[model samples]
Target: MNDDMTHEPSDTTGPRRLTRTRDGRMITGVCSGAAAYFNVDPTLVRIGAAVVTILTSGAGILLYAAAVLLIPEEGKDVSIAQELINKQTSRN
Candidate 1:
């Protein structure tokens, strides 16, 4: 005489924000940033970009350049040395 089991649906999270990575950058950080945003390997993104560039006759280069100029870098992780540098510069 026990029948009472109700379950609520799980909430889904949205996609990760796309931003250029400061640490994982190779050239302009576009591929690494995209990899982080899409939750994939950076090499995959690089290879895909290369394939697109080949197939589209260099359009991918333009797109990548645009992304470099438009996308903002991920949250800046300030280091102790950087903090000290900022402090010293501010005093001068």
Candidate 2:
């Protein structure tokens, strides 16, 4: 058996991380980050979010807020909600 044939190829792009983008952001960048992850236009995501929010009687707003707290900003490791939970637990 050849040594070269036993090794698997490595990915150059590395794993895809879902992080909020600093560029082209309207607010918290949740839609932009999701758009980047899905490889779609940010505008489309924003429009869809708006429509969902309207149709769902503003439930989408809560979902968007949750995403903002759960999704880490670009260049950061932990998310806002995670940090807050950690702080609260540490204080006890």
| Winning candidate number (TM-score) | 2
Q: Each candidate's root-mean-square deviation in Å? A: 11.6, 9.6
Tens digits of per-residue lDDT for model 1, 1-92:
22222111122274456767765689978788788767677788999999999999999999988787667666644533456678999999
Q: Model 2 TM-score?
A: 0.82
lDDT of each: 0.71, 0.81
What 10-residue stretch in candidate 2 is worst by lDDT?
A: 3-12
Q: Using lDDT, give the best candidate's number.
A: 2
lDDT of 2 by residue, 1-92 (tens): 65432322122266877888876689988888888777677888999999999999999999999999999997788999999999999999
How far does residue 46 in candidate 2 sit from its true spot (Å)?
0.2
Q: Write down the TM-score for model 1.
A: 0.63
Candidate 2, residue 60: the lDDT equals 97
What does candidate 1 score in Cα RMSD to the true structure? 11.6
